[model samples]
Target: MFKLFKHLAFCAAFLVAVSASAHSFKIGELEVIHPHARPTTPGIQNGVAWFGVKNAGASDDRVIGVESPIADHAEIHDMTMDNDVMRMFKVDGVPVPAGETVTLGQGNKLHVMLMGLKQPLKEGDAFDMTVHFEKAGSVPVQVWVEQPSAASGAMQHQEDQHDHSAH
Candidate 1:
């Protein structure tokens, strides 16, 4: 039937689009998966990129740095609480244990800090970045910028608390 053929064509196109947007890269034995960022408001100088790094090798490695053309500098940062106050600081490196996965994102964990933004990151935008590892060297990745509503569940939950409509 014509309807059935049309439906199959639509599904095929959708699947290809999804797979194309899902970007990943590997450096030696390190696998970086689904690097993404949230859209930032105008004039916001900083944005964060989240991703997972899996080390499949027997030897441990470290994430030493990150570089992006969209910002002046990109660094590895960690959020911590001290005396009920939250603080963020640059970390020397993020350890990737042998055969283990390390996640970088918001909420008291390691994430890539993009400082001195050249421009606000908008939804549906894609950018290139390179992550440097201690043993694996540098691996280039494509980062997708998603709207706030499309952010990860953890980020969406944080945004929900700040929603003013409930007041």
Candidate 2:
């Protein structure tokens, strides 16, 4: 039954993304590859967040920004490597091609970041988040809070260096 529902949801999402209005695309769910939690260290209202999104539609979509009650601002962030130093900065927009899935994983590659969060987030908690696509309209996505675990065997590894061991 669970698998059935999962397939159904995916199918529905695919349908929505395909039937979007002109000049606009649609998304269904945005999933955090491996959600983790931590208490704010200091001088930070909330910690940054990351996740992946899949769009199975006929048109291109661009993830712009997001809005949530938990954060004062949400935006797309891209990671850069500078002479062995890693850096993170906001991207003007994230493009999602038709029938393709965009991954927002760790190593500060491409993901959503909730800046100026109103509250702290932890594992086992669920929060409502919205993803705004340039051509696609915003979609209400649920972010499931998770914990830091060595389960994936690549939690500490950089996003680009992760081997396809999970497969």
Candidate 3:
């Protein structure tokens, strides 16, 4: 009976650790949810990171920057269509409205561009990253690398198609 109880205790602790590692994190009133990147092909120098930023505070906040050792530079990028051409431009900050969630990745509208990648992001890998906010200061986060076909930005594609049909 004693040995069986010990085994169950160990199992419970292991499960807790695994679940905690996969959970979201918060800094003050800012919540960072499921921060992840997609696996990159060999020799690709650029990658993208996506996550949901929820602001529970009564005031607004801005995400000013992101830093990661795996990349030489990281910046916020915005994509738009101009005269039948799609273009991407760097933005200084992303605004998070009060009591709302700002999704950083949705059909290329907004994303964290990781330029000059030191190495290819592999599936099931994770790296340390820091998100700088105007009001919340800096918060450390883990950016997980997921499968290429994951449901990260794919949902946005379907939404885009639906939107186009309305026009």
TM-score of each: 0.75, 0.62, 0.75
lDDT of 1 by residue, 1-167 (tens): 99999999999998897787676799888999889887889987788787889999999999888999999998876655556544567799988999998877634466777888899999999999998899989999999998533335775444323322211
Worst 10 residues of 2 by lDDT: 21-30
What's the count of clashing pairs in each model shown? 0, 2, 0
List per-prediction Cα lDDT, in the order shown.
0.79, 0.57, 0.79
Clashing pairs in 1: none
The candidate 1 region of ten consecutive residues with least summed lDDT is 158-167
Q: Give the candidates in order of TM-score, highest first.
A: 1, 3, 2
Candidate 3 segments exceeding 4 Å error: 1-22, 148-167
lDDT at residue 83 of model 3 (Cα atoms):
64
lDDT of residue 78 for candidate 3: 74
Better of 1 and 2 by TM-score: 1
lDDT of 1 at 89: 75
